[model samples]
Target: MMTGTIENRDVFLANIAKRFGRAPKTEIDRPTWQYNPQNRVLKEATKNELVEVLVEQCKNIHTDIVITNTANLPADLQKVVGNYGGKSVITWKDERFQNYALSSLMTEQWPLENIQLYEWDSEQPEENIRQAEKANIGITISEITLAESGTAVLFSSKDKGRSVSFLPENSIILIPKSTIVPRMTQAARWISEKVRNGELIASCINFITGPSNSADIEMILIVGVHGPIKATYIVIEDQ
Candidate 1:
């Protein structure tokens, strides 16, 4: 499977630098923002508080929230899938599925019988999108979750297809409570540090909230026309 980690970072960076007629720099200077108030927003909040913040934000995002743990994830996920009509389901090929015992849940543990399940296969790129488009629900685990905006920063890799979150009728994100943060500022700071250190990072990052609805023309609300009709965030509290 394709991974986001770039092992030979120097060689990789040098190739790009050669095109620009310059040598790759070994270090990067961090930026100093004078008006950085983002650090103070929910800076003192505990993990529980962060989760609460996410819960409150979800109220405005049209998301169905569920609080669960590793041990109980299977049951809760099954419940959500069943509620969404689990005739067909697609999910990312993440190790967390095995850690949370959800591989079995998708393969066989659904309370409803005859549920068709699919895991996004990196090898078959076209097939992945085709299956996702037909899936009734698409599920994925969040890499970084934002409490302030109720957003999931999905670091898309080959194993984690971007289409899974958007192609399906319903989107279900599994968030580890530990990954929850105050806002996008923290997310940006983290990715910046990783990039500076020449560490592995995703080529494409998708910031997704609950299904999008537009209300631009004189504040007239419109739903279910642009994206998934429903989205759910299942927060694993003790991951």
Candidate 2:
């Protein structure tokens, strides 16, 4: 049976090669051309300028943007959750939140007596997903932001589940200003370079532009059909 399957695969490939008028090669060849026109503009953009464009594009896509310094992030987070009346929040298990002292602030703002705060657990994924699905807000860290299209890139690991940013009514992303790239092409190049340099890559890389929406049923627009209805980005300038 295995030999028959292998022969069938070979026959399929041979047919494809014949249709293309070329011989099937045993090895794969990587492309040599890699040039993006936006790289120059991206390199010339100032941090503030990138933030401006990013905010503009985000707003255009119905996503909110908040600019805050590292020290004031906790306070801003409090405001955002307070405005949304979020009682339960799920956050990624990342140390950057600890470094920014968000845990303490979150406890103070949403005490154990009033709110439910959950963290993603790598070992207990099913439990984590269950908790995250019931949470009112999902908070995750974005390593890269594309200013040109207002896209935020997230690398998913055992510690950082993809559902942490999707299975909630509201999604909040924390991004540092330094990680803001000009476009998606640059972001792809950076990831490729990281892989080429022996850096450990995550199992999933998500590029989220805004809240999930669908308008397929009719001309009417609907939001949060597949993911969060509201998306907020907290851009830290000094971090």
Candidate 3:
């Protein structure tokens, strides 16, 4: 396995700094933009309006949208899985599933429905990838949701693998209403704040918009050619 070790990065930078007759800067102070236009778009939009905007954008991306509360999420999720023709499922081993009352989904519901469930095991990464590759549907909880582009920001940790979102035939995203932002600007700000606070960011941060969309040589629009064939966003109204 390649560790991607950069053994001479500091020395290389130091040589460049020496050629310029200056020391390498450890930090840079960027000028704040006097005119910020990103904060203006959907600035006045209410939480409900943001949800509406997300729904409208989903239409263009060919993604299914489901609005459900915490109480009905398990049932609604089951129905969605069935709609997507899912026979097996793969999901991240996240604690948020228990927080959102989905802990019994695999133990109770999927067992009753005779659907196989696979949880990503960090210790067995090879098996995890194989399960994700074979699973019919992959489900994940979004840490941040952008309403403008209908995008879900997922911060991948040891328990969260990116393959669960990309290698499956179908993708299901669970988005809480509280995590919905006006656009990517808010998401970027959140990440910047984390970095500024000297917090360790996840190794992988995924900005998944929808399923894989591709065009053929004839300009024929094809969905899910090499990635997930379908994607669904389940937005929780009351988290």
Candidate 4:
């Protein structure tokens, strides 16, 4: 009788585990920013100014920049980013990115030859994760990023595999101004749609708020302990 009861209990626990995903004991909370379309301060800001603000607020000891569009970068900043030994990775969605006009720093004569370009299509699950671990910067596009909480939704797809965004040391997300939404509930609705379409795998979905941080050691503050040390969102202005 005892053995049968124990087996039943074990089965029940297993069922619960299957339904709910595994995560750490604690998670870092992110700061939220409310969206105001009428606010001319944010809306009127140029891409350069917006990028500058992101860098100012988010930069820390570990700063790896992942840029989505190398082609469209301003000429002056190109030389500066190159000197920093930044890694460049391009997403496969050229048609969708057509509006931004992203280009690479590596050209015929001015070869940023050292800057490695990681094509999103070539990575497998394990390899993608491994590469991301070694890479300091991960630059990619967000379908509908939120300024409401500095949230960037990385929809998990085979083409974009999860690791490309999650595992890197630093993540620089490129969000066109048009995609910013006002609330988390709206983002949740979009996520549900993707899940229904059979695009997302794994029961657990992650929403990162800011750079990874911890104060475990004698209550001393430390950054980049659990995840990327820094995360910046580039709100590309269409205007």
State which candidate has the highest TM-score. Answer: 3
In angstroms, the error of model 4 at 136 is 2.1
> Candidate 1: deviation at residue 145, Å?
0.9
Best-to-worst order by lDDT is 3, 1, 2, 4
Lowest lDDT block of 10, candidate 1: 103-112
What is the C-alpha local distance difference test score of each model?
0.88, 0.85, 0.91, 0.55
Output the number of the lDDT-best candidate: 3
Better candidate by TM-score, 2 or 3:
3
Worst 10 residues of 2 by lDDT: 105-114
Q: Write the per-residue lDDT of candidate 1 for residues 8-102, one digit (tens) a residue.
A: 88888999999999988888997987987878999999999999999999999899999999889888988998899888988888888888876
Candidate 3 residue pairs in backbone clash: none
- Name model 4 segments beyond 4 Å from true: 1-84, 87-99, 103-113, 192-205, 215-220
Candidate 4 lDDT over residue span 1-239, tens digit each: 35533457656766776678743233468666697444433555554554554444445423333333434454433443354356654333334444455444323123454555554554455666666777656666677654445566665555665566666766666666666555466677777787889874535445655667678759887877777766665555554
RMSD of 3: 3.1
Off by over 4 Å in 1: 1-35, 108-111
**lDDT, model 1:** 0.88
Model 3 per-residue lDDT at 172: 98
What TM-score does model 1 achieve against the real structure? 0.84
TM-scores, in order shown? Answer: 0.84, 0.85, 0.87, 0.56
